[model samples]
Target chain A: MDVSQELADYAAKHTTQVLERSQPVQVDMGLLAAFDNTPIDPSEYSSDLDAHLLQLTLTSTQALISALFALPTTPSAEHGPVIRPPVPSTILPREKPLPKPKEPTKWERFAQAKGISHKKRDKKEWDEERQEWVARWGRDGKNKQKEEEWATPVKAGMEADQDPAATARAERKARTAKNEKQHRSNLAQAAASSSASSRRTAQQARAADLERSMLVSKSATASMGKFDKSIEGEPKSRGVKRKFDENVPKAGWKGEKEGLLGVLKSVESGLGRKEKRKGETKEGEVVVRKAVRYHDREERLKAGRGGAGGGRGRGGARGRGRK
Target chain B: MRPLTDEETKAVFEKLANFIGKNLVHLIDRDEDDAYCFRLHKDRVYYLPLSMLHLATSIARPNLVSVGTCFGKFSKSGKFKLGVTSLDWLAKYAKYKVWIKPAGELPFLYGNHVVKAHLGRITEDTPEHQGVVVYNMADVPLGFGVTARSTLDTRKLDPMGIIVFHQADVGEFLRDEDTMF
Candidate 1:
């Protein structure tokens, strides 16, 4: 047991750790071959330096001598610049800009003439035959046509605001449009209110317009014709059939079979009789007026064009013989 | 004003369909089927259904491309040519995206081929050879691209090789074509 303990202790104590020794170490010259400490001769170095210098001198001498000898032939101080005869002056020497682009040759012009043009798209052609402007795309747009028709007219309303005549025409046009619209809306509103109301009001409106027009024509005719004020309340001879006078207000007169002729004849007969008029004078009379306004609309429009050619003798020779 | 012929109307309808898939059935008001009004250079105009510009504005907020536009252009002949602007607007919602790193921004913007290593990341599941948006690291879209490599191999890619075609880039706006790379 004791021996084991001693062996264990010895094993524990026995370690690979080295002890630090503070003693100075000595070197022996005889133990190892001595290295010579003396410096080597500088001849190799000097010879290498001489060789480098000689090489430099030879290269410099060859290059410098050649350069000096060839100086006369090469571009030197006396020569201004390397004149490149082939090239014209460039920006470097501040010469004029290169020649302006040359005109296209004949063949080029031909090719261009034959080339398709993009200008067609922007062109607006006046179709004089159709009396309208034709556009490049999709039959000159409908919207543009509409604006031209409707909006241009409105702009005309603005264009001649300063000219009294034009302004008056514009105002009349506006008034006409407003009146038409108002009448339409009133009708609509009435119809919405009640069908009977709408019908009655429309009938009234038509009657009012007819009566006003007839009265206006009668006054105009009386003023033009030889209306004797002395016989205003007297009857004419019953057997004497009145002659048709063309001098009467022909301004609004149409054929006897059409328009207000029958009513006018009846009213005039009453006026001549000097009796209390009661036939067509009822306030609520339907009094529908049908004027035979016959003409091809296109022809009428064409005829009215160019501000010329209309039956313009409305202020007729007031029976020049009678005058 | 010239009312559109049946053929021209049909052509315009086809164009609108191709441009927006004709899917905006909600935008069509049958009564006022006069939405596609076009004012022409010659002071001519007409109305048709589908006011695409109005619809785009209501939907696009202030991000309208070619601002104040209605999402269609006109040919010289006055025909409506649609969809050039719609493509750019729709690219933002596209799934395939390549985010370029900051170091590669200039090259990418200059219409250079986007190298795989220079990309920060490619969104997962992006298909190869499909159109994609090229985005900077800040997540702002630079322009469009065609993916040249698969999304899976984005990390381990052949060095200095192209990853996507710089189809259209911000460089078109940043610098002139002559000065750009």
Candidate 2:
């Protein structure tokens, strides 16, 4: 009738259905195997399978309802409709309050606080504090403790612990002396080498400077000669005229005239005599005159022929005559 | 040699303007007398002037012959056929197409031909409502077609302008001549 009663009834019915459906089916393994082998179409068997499933579900629902109804119901807490005895409270008593933290001192707070600026302490004060701290933990303090423990000296063959500070001081003193001696020696060697190197460099610089000057002078001399030659070769009308005048002969007195006249004169008379011979025969003279005329004519004809041939050949050969 | 018809010229100009507008990274308008300046999403502004469109058409017409080989020529009789579909593809297809940087320093290869004239800065005179980049024929790199400056400031003389006639201009500037010293 009430909402709670309705919910309980529905839950009981639903549980009974689920329990009844869960019951195992009595499937024949051999028959199922044979059915699997036959491989019936899913659609063909779906309706039949659906009917069986529906029956199984209904049976499951009935069985589930019976099982749920068999269980006893507990009374609701809020309702308090059916109370037997008052139950004891299970919660434990509250714990004691934790102790409050101590407040920090001004100095401690300042140190702990982030990004706080502090006035710089004097170096002397810092040094004093540092010295006090060092004294407490220094090698001397440690050695003193060792001395007290070993005051009853080692018996017979047992070796004693060496004082580390003394050994260290002695070793440092020896090393410092050796290093100082080597440093002075190295300084002397470096100074000697440096002076030598500087002297050598200076000498090389002088040689290079000298060589450069020599090269400059040589080039200057060469350039001066070149300048003179260029000056002589440069175009100048007056110089050209003078050189031409010296090289050329007088136009009227041709080279051919001089040579021919000299040769003719020499042939006419015996080498020394300039005049004609006294024994001149008229017949011989006439014959000589005829011969000279014939020879002159022959030479003229030969000259004309050569000129004509050259002109004809040149005209015919034109472009082909280069080779 | 004859001037193109007004209708024909306008059509050509529109084609080139559309191509350049789509391809180029528009720079800022440095003019006082411009009507509408476009500001590209990138910091540059483009000043579109009627005069620039005309110049772009004139330069682009001569290159059309080459454009035709790839994208068939426009019908003499008016017909609805698109020119080269893609400027990027046309650049690769065309043998003599020139690539130019519309602004900033001209590559060293351009030398004197690379014009370096300052167009005025963007101000009250040039109101950039629509994002556009302003570029001039001078800004185009060597071998690229020339376009008119949208701004009137460059209508007169620009002294810093250098025109490199050929690739050799850069070599001449570099002076590859051997020196004894």
Candidate 3:
């Protein structure tokens, strides 16, 4: 009887059970998340926030581990045991807004108006003569069967020069070209309808440019629009009227004359500077006169003129040359 | 008719400078009473004096056949081509001159290029491809052309080698009489 308290304490310490919560913890093994929806006691929470949060987290973790263990396990060759998480039950919020629907094409609108439902077609078709299935289109497709045949019969009333194979191939190509043209028109219609205001302004700008070009061409005749054939109800093409300086302005012609001189100055400065330099010598360059005089003296000395009386002989020779 | 725009003025000046060289300054800077200006009328450029410009203002653009000396006309492609009418201005201020013999005068007037056999004399130190005024033995300005060879280079040319390339000649006045205006 006295060992009851000690036995209880020993059992509490040895047991593997986690602290219990007022309400059960919700576990989602797929998301590995647990929700504690139980109300908290103010006294316990206020007494110690760390202990209270720690106890709450431990309880939720214990619930999650138990739920994970309950899942059906399979033995893997590499791993000892493996458990597959089930699909999540919670509907999480999306991060982005829903995508916009694409604009319907031309043919789609026409089909909707006509209440036509789309029917899926098989890619391969059975060829009765070949006894095999062939692609409806693309490489070696059934569409080219007539052109690929060995003996193609000429249709009645056909031209003698017309080739059956060539005609068949041309017809196939024409069909594709027609489809491509229709697809382009569909895209254009979609683009136009999507931005109505912007497209309208663009069309107006193009129309104005076309009108201006037409006016310019109309006036481009040899007679300067005078002898050009006039179109009925066509608006008169107003040319850019020539604007000239007043023949007799209040200000005298001195101002205009000055302006003209200014232009001439600029032109001359651009051209004459380099040409003038071609005739003039550069600054700080020595004259070659002394070199020429030295050469002359050497020539005189070489002409049998001695050293002592060379000056007097040079003077007498100069006097003779002058005479 | 209106005064030439600056771009048109520059174009005309550059073309004029090809023959006249620095003498272009004399054309623009003149006596106050003898001041002149350039005007564009129906693609043709006119070099008219101030007094004449004042008188011609009364005539309507379409009625005014011509205002002053028709120095040159702009082509359909906007390139300026000197007319034979501007020979007076070019000859007066020509920097380089080429004189042709009397026999070659007729051929040159007929728009033939000046050949070595026809070349009488050329300006000394004239560079290749320089614009030169063609003259006759009597010093009469026959036309204008671009030189094919410099003065020194011409000495090496054969008798039949071209000396100057024909550009514009006075013969155009008679040949192109209809569109000369």
Model 3 Cα displacement at A122 (Å)?
Answer: 99
CAPRI-style class, candidate 3: incorrect
Per-model DockQ against the true two-chain complex: 0.01, 0.01, 0.21
Residues B1-181 of candidate 1: C-alpha lDDT, one tens digit per residue: 2223333434444443322222323223223444333211122222322344345335432353232223344456757543223335434355567788999998887768898768887877554565677778887877666777666645567879888876666666556445321
Q: What would the per-residue lDDT of candidate 1 be over residues A1-323, giving only the tens digit for each residue?
A: 35998887888787323212233122122231112223333674477876654544454444434434433343557775332222222223546777645444444556689994434344566666688767733445432443344233344445554444445557656766887886676557545445554456666789777766654454576464247343353322223564432312234223311322333334335443432222223345643321223435555566655434441243223333344
Q: Which candidate is the best by lDDT?
A: 3
Give the per-residue lDDT of model 3 (tens digit) for A1-323: 59999999999998655667778898888899999988987998999998888888888888998898999999999988999899998789999998666779877888899999877899999999889999999999999988988987777998989878898999999999999999898878777777787657577889878878878898888887888788886666675886767555458767766666676667667667645443233234544655688988887776545533345556667756775
Please give me the DockQ of candidate 3 compared with the native complex. 0.21
DockQ of 1: 0.01
Q: Work out the TM-score per prediction.
A: 0.23, 0.12, 0.43
- Whole-model lDDT per candidate: 0.48, 0.36, 0.84
lDDT of 3 by residue, B42-136 (tens): 99999989899899988987899998899999889888888899999999999999999998998999889999999998999887777899999
| Tens digit per residue, CA lDDT, model 2, A1-323 | 46998898888887533212232423222222111122334663586886655545555445444444444556788874432322333344669886555444444455778656667743322225235532332354432333335345445654477554455457656766887886676666555555775555555789777766654554477564345434333332222331212111245224423432343333323422311222222222555656788998888667656754333345537635654
- Model 3 chain A lowest lDDT segment of ten: A278-287
